[model samples]
Target: MRHRLLALAAGTALLATTACGGQDSPSQEDGELTPLTAGVIPIVDVAPVHLGVEQGIFEAHGIDLTLESSSGGAAIVPGVVSGEFDLGFSNMVSLIIAREQGLPLTTLTNGVTSTGEQGADLGGVFVSGDSDIESAADLESARVAINTLSNIGDTTVRQSVRVAGGDPTGIEFVELPFPDMPAALETGQVDAVWAVEPFGTVIRQAGGREIASNFVDTDPDLSVAAYFTSEQRLAEDPELFASLTAALEESLAYAQDHPDAVREVMTSYTEIDQSVVDALILPRFPSEIDRDSVQTLADLMLEDGVIDAEADLDGLYR
Candidate 1:
């Protein structure tokens, strides 16, 4: 079964007009900075952004960063494409789909890479403690909930089901926000849910059963999320883009070495308990963008028909 998401053509066109400008020389003044509107989902994958803000990295780099919380990658992609946001966080799957549809966006930096561990990556598919679904195959005809359709969660779950020799098409996928997934599962509204970070850890702590993990079943090197912006913004203000990237890279490094610091920052933005943050396997943070890693996502989307055509990913990095 195919699911159609809201198209981004109109929003893309608007972003092109508002965010793009004729190339300008790099800014000379260092202290005075322009405000950048950034969109992000409040998942653990975006710990860098949160850490950067908490640690004043952006301020040190002369960037007045304004963060806007979005529903998911679906909302964030459009926000970046339409110039509503200068840069935003997005998953590889969503970015590939948008590029295929002709959105002139580019990845500014890498966010996180999944390490296929039992409690990491595809570790989000959870069942109630008393549920009979003990394995991936058992979820064949069961109802599953994902944060969003056609994004990483959906793709990973489908691939996991396929690997288990189950017909992915036989399952029903429902969309539920991350915050509500635990309740939905507890009440038997859904048999399993593909969540990430704190939510996944939360369910497990609450006695939910994890049937399978995406990292163990799907491709291991898959990138979970990254920082992306409109190409026009980069072309017009290379200095600003570089500053943002540098600050983010620094924050990414800090997040890896200081998971406790990241947890403190996360408390400011997410409702996830501090205990969950401590237990979660923090995602890998890369400073530079990796075209090959992103290309893998595009290839997978093309094979899955999530994207209408193959994307020209070579020049999609800033």
Candidate 2:
């Protein structure tokens, strides 16, 4: 589930030891662009940022970023919380759950959302061709694979299953990385796999078929992932914040304008073959946060017990 995923870490064991030191804005040392490290997952949702880095988008803004892959908030959150990573690419549900569990985070920019085209291949629950599952309702008492649990992966599935007239409470969620899902589905390790973007397209090519489209099934226009930082960093370095945001947005626009180029750049971040890359169905790159969609997600989380309280969405984003 990536854009639909979550990796939340709690307790002192996962806490970051260091937080970023305070700074006013982007720093320059003898005219060198400021360098910052970022935490990310190599999924389609994060392609814009990677494309920006690959094609000098960030460099053009007088900044350079080092992107490190992390599955979900479990690793990404601690890095940001401890000041180890300047920014993190992750899903909204993962961030919200982390915040609910005591992580202080801030939204940088909206990442990917549904393309608003029904069944256009954004994200879905898939099963191998010979599998008996034919609909979301068939998923009851089945083993489902998700990149991470208790975040977008499980949340969206529950919503879709309910919509399909099934009791999701009987569904068993298993954590399987996206790269392993196709094989898992093929080998019968999982009855259905929830996947997004290029991975979804990859699975379908490998004899996998859709059981339900989570993005569209849950909400036609859903806010999936975003680039974010800890609240500590935002307060510590407002200037760097502004600069990074401008550069990231510029790169996002480039991604939207040049889909083919965006896919080419994506191959560098993911292990999918160039052949697969050439035919992927790209998720829409949203320019700004959608408060209504976020609010709707929060309401669902609250209903599902993923969050104990309503998240202050306006305070978390611009």
Candidate 3:
């Protein structure tokens, strides 16, 4: 099955805006503050970053942060590489693949971990409740929808199908966005879709049945999301990089302790219902990168022929 994984831009005249609704300004305080541009998708996976902003953690650390919402990692990586974004959210697999392909990016922080229990919260593959797809195996020779090709959603679903004894290569994969999956499924544009967050929850709420959850099939310890920065940013400002980590660490701590508060803050940005927000499975927020977990994803990409080389994992940590 060719997994269709779905899932940034910058300009100045563009003063990067953090989720906190403030403009970032360059700092003169040496290591005290830095004007940083960060990108995120407006999903629960990024709740901690928003929590950090809501709780004043980033501000407390003297960091002027600007956060731009991106549609997918495709946009985020280019922004980071082009110096438009100092750091952005990226999947471990995507980052490793990009780096092996010479994108000059490195993981700065571990963001969210997806588990089977939290599968619906992050995203998953779903079939209409009345459909004949009772298990992932039913997806064989079936039509499937993905947010994008060669992205996290696609790769995740591919793995899920394989584990269920279905040939991932045997399925037809169509590209669609998360918001449109429900209609697509109803209209027979596709039989199923691999999605995250709101869309997954929406499908279930509307009577769609989940055939498989990537989180359940995939290990929870897998690093699904992370913050990444370019080698240029690290070299010019190691202290700034450290500040970003510290800020995110503070955010992660706050988010884990106050899920309600994080949800409240997010309502202003996303259209996801407050009720859905409360019910969603929250991702585990580990502040530091786990090299081993990341390496596993890198190895998978290699097996899939997504990258030309293995990621050089040395010196990948601070």
Q: Which stretches of candidate 2 lie over 4 Å from their true place?
A: 1-24, 27-29
Error of 2 at 135 (Å): 1.0
lDDT of 2: 0.79
lDDT of 1 at 167: 72
Q: Which residue pairs does candidate 2 place in steric collision?
A: 1-5, 7-74, 18-82, 25-239
lDDT of 1 at 292: 62
Error of 3 at 5 (Å): 14
* lDDT by residue (tens digit), candidate 2, 33-121: 77788998877778888888988988877776889998765568667866788888777887787666657788888888877665675
Off by over 4 Å in 3: 1-33, 116-121, 315-318
For candidate 1, write residues 196-254 as lDDT tens digits. Answer: 77888889889997887864566566667788887877777787788888888898898
User: What's model 3's lDDT at 314?
Assistant: 66
Per-residue accuracy of model 3 over 24-117 as CA lDDT, tens digit each:
3324455555567788887778878877776778877777677789877776776776667777897776666565555667777788877547
- Candidate 1 wrongly placed segments (more than 4 Å): 1-12, 15-27, 289-293
Candidate 1: worst-modelled 10 consecutive residues by lDDT: 1-10
After the best TM-score superposition of candidate 3, give how far the Cα of residue 32 lies from its true spot, in angstroms.
Answer: 8.3
Provide C-alpha RMSD values for all models, in order. Answer: 2.7, 3.1, 4.9
Query: What order do you get sorting by lDDT, best first?
Result: 2, 1, 3
lDDT of each: 0.76, 0.79, 0.70
